[model samples]
Structure formats: C-alpha cells, structure tokens
Target: MNFLPTDDQLAFRDTAVRFAREKLAGTYLQRARIHTLDRQLVREMGALGLIGPDLPEEFGGMGLDYTTAGLMTEAIAYGDFNISYIQLLASLMGGMVAQHAGRDISMEWIPRVIAGEKIIGLGLTEPRGGSDAAGLQLKAEKTANGWRLNGEKTSMSAADQADAAVIFARTEDSTTGSNGVSAFFVDLTEKGISRTHFDDIGTKPVGRGSVFFDDVVIPSECLMATEGRAFGTIMAGFDFSRALIGLECIAPAQASVDETWAYIQEREAFGAPLAQYQGVTFPLAEAETQLTMMRQLCYYTLNLRDSGNSHTAEAAMCKWYVPKTTCEIIHQCLILHGHYGYTTDLPFHQRYNDVLGLQIGDGTAQIQKLVIAREKVGRVALQYDKQAKGGAA
Candidate 1:
C-alpha cells in the first residue's frame, strides 16, 4: 500500500525529467513544425539509458521494472509529447526481440536497439482495418527459402524511418481468426519493400505511414514464437505498453494544467487575478483531481504487471480513461489561456493535437471499454458472440 516511489524510481524519474527539460522541451515545437525529429536526440536518449530501462542488463538496459519504466515515460512526456513514443517502442519491440527473436538476432539487434542505433516498428494494423488486429489480411506464404510476404501495413508508427519491424501476417486461412496470425521480425530495408509516409496531424516525429512488402523473403529463423500462435503470445505485452501510453498522454496534459495555473495566478481580469475567480479556479481544481486519479490508476496498473497479476481490466481502464480525461483537461487548459492557447505561440495547442491521436491509437476508448467489459463479465460477455449462438439458450 506504499504510495511513494522507491529511491531508484525517484533517481530515474529525476534524470528523465532533467533530460526532457534540457533536451526535448526547447526543441519539441521547432522539430514538430517540420514534421521531423533529430535522430541524434534518440541516440542521446539511448546513451542515458532512457530508451528501455526496464529491459534486462544483458540487453544493455538498466533491468528496472515496468512501474519505473512508466515513470521515465511520464517524465519524458512532460517535455516532449511525441518523443515518448521512442521510449514506448523501445520497451515494446525490445521486449519482443529479447524474449521471442532468435538468439543470433537478439544478440545482433537488441543491444543496438537499446543504444538507439536502430528503430523497430510494430506492423500489426493493415490498410483494411486496425480494430480487429487478429483478423489481419496480410498474406505470408511459405517459400523454399523462407516466408514470402505480400501485403501492406498502414498507420504504422516509424514506418519509413524504422530499421526493422515486428510484422504479423496470416499464415493460415482467415477462418482461423486470431490463431491464423504469425509474427515476423523483418528487416525493413530488405528487397521488394516500399514505404510511404503520412501527413499525420500529431506525433510527427514518429512518422505514421504505410509499408508495402511485395514478395519479400524472410529467413525462417525470423519467425517469432510459434507460427499462428504468435498473436496472443506477442500481444501479451501490449497491456504494459497501453499503460505507458496512458502516462504519456497524462504527462503533457498535466504539464499544460500546471502552466495554466501559473498563468491564471499572474494574469488579471477585472482588476483581479484569474485564479481569484471561482469559475477559472474550480475547473482547474477539478482537472487536478482527475489527473491525480488517472495517474494513480496508471502506476497501479503497471504495478499489477510487475507483480505478475491479472491487470487486463486495469490496463484497459488506464488506456481509455487517461487519454479521454487528458483531452478534456487539456482543452480546458487551452481555453484558460484566453486565445494565446489558440495560437501556435504556446505549447498547449500542440499538446492538444498530440493527445487527440492517443484517444484513437493504442486501442480506442470504445475498444478499451469492450476489453474491460469482457474481463469483468467473463463468459457472459461472449453470450452474444456468433460462435456462442449454437450453445446459448
């Protein structure tokens, strides 16, 4: 029932906070203006062990827990809303590489990924749809040499910039549903691969776009986990990333609120500071309360993960609750800024744009709620399923 962060968590948080303020805060907007990120900054993050601190020591990580990982992500988000995705990707893909990829592949790539020398993107969502992740349409056929991939993955983060990707394709018939999908660690630069970048509204640094694989040959050893069983195994770690995504959105929203509070306290209206008025102050108070609640839930979900407990419902709660609340809170902060927030002159607008994307990505609010419902109701949640029709009364 301890609420305080341990000494190691505090040290990591302090370092991440300092790194964000010093390196990311000042340049975040300027970089976003051009929809580009300095690759060197990622390397700097790797140098500081900020990329994947929760990864094992053998993989060039600090071997911390998921809760500590969330703290680093939250602190980094305070300075740069979009760059925290780098940390998120590091944790997600790096964990997969360490645990699922072959030994030679892990030895060659894991350390480099930890050092920020390479970037790995998740290629699960296709151009057809994203919500039904297991029902992917990408085709992977067995070849004499290995697997031949022929499909396009759209809305992928780091699509054009990623050195590699953990791609999922259907090795079996679509009738197999989730069980038909197989994961592959493919080199993005391999022959027959083509990519195009998207003009996304936010999180510009990690460009989202489509990656087309046209009969690309992948070695057999590149297969991750058991073929056709990879979807559930690889996706087991998604709960961890969902919680981190929650913190990423919350951190920026919290920052905007803090900045707005300072503004209202100093700015005057009708010969009195804005903070003196209940209309202005009360909403801020409400926002603070909600932020505190969401923050506690996020870390608690991570703690559940670190303790090896079932947190599917809690992670879904964090993913849905945090971003939805963040959008509302940041919108208020924007309004509180009184037209200054409307302009690009301040970071509030940018944060708003950045957070809106989260509400859609990493499973939407509706999808998360469905997950929560499924977890809570158990078999009752599946009573209306098409497959359950035969057994239902």
Candidate 2:
C-alpha cells in the first residue's frame, strides 16, 4: 500500500511541524519538568485545528483520515513529546466518544475537546492492573436516573486535569473478566470524585494519576455501547492509538538522532570530528534505518485502520516494538553525546525519559507480543495456559 502523503496531508503535516518547531520546541524542556500542561498552549493547538483533526466535520474536526492523524501526531511529537499526548488522547478518546456516545454527548464534548476548551481522559486501567484491561473491578450499578460508580482508575494520563473521562466499570455482579464491563462518560467535577498525581520520572506534563470514583453518578445516556459488552467495542480504538503512539515515541528519538548528527559534525574527538569516526556514525546510521522502518510500520498500521482492515497484530507490533526500539535508539543517542547527554541542558535525557514511559504505558512489550501471537494463532496460543489452570481449552 502507498504510504505517501497527499497534498492535503502534507499541508497539515507542514502546519503541525511549523507550530511545533516555532512554539513547542523552544519550551519543551521547561514544559517537560512541570506536572500540569499549560492550558493556554493546549488551546492554541486547538485553535490551529491540531488536536483532533480526524474525528469528523460535524464534531469540529476536518474529517481527515487516520493516516493524516498519524502524520499530525508525528510532526507535533517532534517538537514536544509530552504535548503530543493531547493529540493522542483526543483522537483515541474522542473517536471512541464520537462512535459510541450519544450524539448530544458527542456534540457537546467533542467540539470542546477539539477546541482545547476541555480534555477527556481514558479511565480503563484500574489500581489492580493495566495490561489485564478486561479484568475490571470498578462497579457501576444502575440507579433511578443513571449509574453510580465506585472504583479507582490508576496510571491514567491527565487524571487530575481532565474535564471528563470515559470510565469503564463492571456491571454484572456474577460475571468476571470482560463480560460484565460497561463504559461510561463521567464528569470529573461530579461529587465523590477525587484524584491523586504520581511523581513520574517522565511525561510529567501528562500527569499520570489515579481517579477515585466514590459513589459518583452519571446520567443514563453516559453509558456507551452495549451495557455488558462495551469492553470489546471501546477497545477497538486502541489499535488506532497504538500506531499513533509508535509515531509519538519515534519523533523524540528522531529529534535526538538529528541533534546528535549535527553535534558530531562540530565536536572533535581524537583531533577529528566525531562524524569521521565509524564508531559514532555507524550507530546513528543504524538508528536512521530503524527509525525509517518503524515510521513506515506505524503509518502502515494507520493506513490499515483507514482501509477498514484488521490490524490488531500490526498495531500490537507497533505498540511493543516501536517504543522499546525507540527507547534504545534514544539511549544510544544520549550516550553518543557523551556526558552532555546526561545533563539537563540538553534534551537527550528528557527525550529518553519521555519515550521510556511508552514502553510501560498502553501495554508492555510482553503484553503486545502476546497480543500479536494471539492474533496470528487465535485462542490456540492461550489454550495451554487455560489447560494448565484446569479451565476448558
């Protein structure tokens, strides 16, 4: 399949790149250290139609394809990796809402999200686990007017800062795993909702935290998809996000590599420029090759999604491989810069730390590999574990 950007896609990418380079790159380091993102900056991105340009024209988006969305993600990420989280969340969470939530809900929130007037965070991962997404413990009991939620979601980006969230809860008392799970659109300002932030090593601006829902209530219209089957339907959006995430991680590593390449030309070692050394140049060359491949893979996955094709395996591959490899590439770039890379004055350390989070967030390498295997061989790959545990295979 062709991965070349069309004129319109290229135009969007150029605009995103210009905004990133001009506005985001200059303050990336300063912004990275902060716990909360600057809302004004987020609004500026919204004003530029850079947040969720792929949602739909009716929802305040430009009706762009997922591939164009990936392009925008990559371009913005090149300037500020953390800031790109906004674009990622908007597309992932906003798309879910647009496709699943009631029209009124989508009409009200999607525009705000697109306008950067509000933020909607995902509430899938619980305090128990993130990778085992279906094993939810949050409770959502039907009330007279709506549902009452009582549970805690952990490791969510923008937990404390989100205006609202798409929360998942188990509605069936006798069921376990994904069966009883239901999704909800809950306002974070509702009563009994509390949040706590973590002192993460990176992506601090995204503010990974726990959102505790204590007897929180939401209207019946908040329920998304089938009551007991929302888990599977809502999760399909992740395949899209996974590919976008690949681009997100790749951008910073790419930026680091680009900087190191320029650096080697000026820095002298052994009375010669570092660029003249095969030892220094070879790793950068290898990095470029890998980056090119990973970028294509990510865009290919996005294209698969745009084409209405099954991409679970490819998305899993992108999710697992790209983040891990990009982290390594960033680390190597950091080392190639010597001690300066370790210092805060340079962006290498920050880029490493920022990209490092993706290796753990979304899903871990081991988990993604399992997903890939499951996709290739179906449930057969997991039958052995079920048999060992005395369950029906």
Candidate 3:
C-alpha cells in the first residue's frame, strides 16, 4: 500500500546517488568500450552492504529486506546505470546460491561474496536458446566422480568478472521435456573453460560474454539442488530475478527523468526555459505516467516474493512492462536533451545505452508475453507455497 521509500532508505538512496555522480557519471564514456566492472566500486558496494544486502550478517551481509534492497537498487541506478545493473545482478545471483545451497556452501562462498571479494553471475542463455532456458543446449553429464560441463553460453553479463557462475545446463534425459535442466556452480578460472566479453550498448564493465566449458569438471557438492528439478529452480529464479530486473528498469528510467528535469529547469530554448514548451512537457509527462505504472507492477511482484506467494504471471507482466517502458523513457529523455543528450558530455546517452540492455536481459519482452499468455490460456500462475508443499523447489 505504501508507495514511498522510508526516510532511512531515502537517505541511503541519496548517498548512493551522490556517490555515483561524483564517482562514475562523468568518467565512463558510452563506448560500451569498458571491459570490466570496477572492482574497487564493487568493494565499496560490499562495504556499504549493497551487494547481497538481504543476506544474513553472519554470511558477511546486512540482510536487508527486499523492499529496502529494491530501494537501494533505485538509489545506485540514479547515479549510473551500469552500477545499478551490476549491483542487482550480483544480488540476485548471490541470493540464488545463498537460498538453495547448504550451510557449507554458504559458509565458504557467501562471506566472500558479501565482502566484495567475489562476484557471481548467471549463465543460462545460449546462442540456440535465448528465451528457452529449459532448451539450453549446454550439457553437464553426471560422472562416477562428479559431472562434466560442455557447452557455450552467449550474451551473458559478468562472465569475465565473476569468480564463479550459477550455470543452468541440460543434465537429464534430453528426450524428456523441461525436466532435463540442472544448475551448477562453475568456477570461471577452471581448466577447459574460455571466457570472452562482447562490446555492448552499455554496462560495458559487466563483460557480456560466452563461457565454453569443454569437459570441465564439477564436484558433486557444487550441484545446486538435484537433477531434473532445475526447471523449477530456474522458473522460480525467474520469478525472483525478473522482478529484480524490473527494479533495474526503474533505476535508469528515474535517472533519465531526473537528468532531463534538471536540464529543463535550467536550459533555455528559444529564450525560454525548455520546460515551458509543450513538446518538452508532454513527453516528460507521458514518460512519467508509463514509469509510474511500471514501478507499481515492480513493487507488486516484490510484495509477492516477500509474502512467499506465487506470481509467475505477474513477474512476466512486470518483466515485459518495465524494461520496454524504461527503454522508451530513456530515449524520450534523451530526445528532450537534443544535442546535449546525444553526446557523452551528459549522462543521457550513457543511460540510453544502459537501458537498452534491460529490454533484452533476464528475458526478452516477447518471452514474458508468451509466459503471460500461457498462464492465462492454460495453467494458473506459478504458486510458490503450494508448489513447495508439493516438493516443487
């Protein structure tokens, strides 16, 4: 019901914003040219308790709630888009490991992650299976010793920067349906693995790349949950990660709006403040309207998570709604800036590139719509509590 950030959250957000502007906004060019996320910044993020903020303190995390964590996402994003992107992705990936793995796994890895000592990224999308996670072509075959992974994941974020990755690969009888997926913890620096980063529109530091593991060894202990059940782990992960992606969308959208607002109040066009023009005002208003709607949906999905309720269809809806809306809002904000926005002189263009990635990351808008349609026309939305009671992750 409350649509506002708490006072402390707001203060934290302001601090993050100031830190971002002072630290990153002016320096990084939108070449999509950078190769790795700033480890120092990441260290600062860990020190601030932003990375895996919701995780337990004993694990070296602050264990903030989803609501507070979501607010922090918006705050970090307000300063620079790439930081927000990296921050949220790290949190979600770490959350998956912390949530599913045993105490031994948590004790060994969680503290390091919370200390900004390590980075975790997800690698599930393959060249052949962009939207179809269950159809992942990567193979992780069970062995007498442990398991062997062999395949390439494409267009993933943070491949090079991550100390480890949460990978979803085919393990069960491929003849079967979505039952074949199994998630694993693959060390990036392991033998028979090659990592490469691509030049992208934004979030250059996160290092979107391909991970090819050729007969790479994985210990049995590194397996998350059990075999043939990863489709549910992945599906539930989407429900959580997708909603978080919505917050990612919201952050850049807010940044674009804030920057545009600042420019309009000060910049004179035709001897009048730019905000005076209907052309400028109307688009801003329209963008705000869309962002408001998207933010509502984002919060709703987060609430579902907090309540331990199933809202898979809602996750799809927000995933589709927020990123697309965010992309649109960023461009509109840029258009208002005219020549200034188009240049790296202002952060508008950087935001434009940053927001571009969100539209496709996590899941494309097309995939989300299909999920929503499938839910409406066939089965009910995914149920977290009920499904868990039935032993469904």
For lDDT, the strongest prediction is: 2
Model 3, 1-393: lDDT tens digits are 566767876776676667766776666564245777777877887786666677777677777667666767776766666777656765687788877765777778878887678878788889987777667778888899889999899888887778888888888654544787888877788899998878776778776888889999988888887776876865576786777778777877877787788889999978999889898888888888888888788777777777788788989987888877787888888888888678866766676777777778878888888788877876443454447679442
The residue-by-residue lDDT of candidate 2 on 335-359, one tens digit each, is: 9988988899999888888988888
| Backbone clashes in model 1 | 0
Local distance difference test, candidate 3: 0.76
Rank list by lDDT: 2, 1, 3
Sorted by TM-score, highest first, which candidate order results? 2, 1, 3
Q: After superposition, how far is residue 48 of candidate 2 from its true place, in Å?
A: 0.9
Across 317-393, the per-residue lDDT of candidate 1 in tens digits comes to 99888888898999999999988889998887788888888888778889889999989887565666855777542
Q: Is candidate 1 or candidate 3 better by TM-score?
A: 1
Alpha-carbon shift of residue 111 in model 3 (angstroms): 1.5
lDDT of each: 0.88, 0.93, 0.76
Residue pairs with colliding backbones in model 2 are: none
Q: Which pairs clash inside model 3?
A: 37-205
The superposed Cα distance between candidate 1 and the true structure at residue 376, in angstroms, equals 1.0
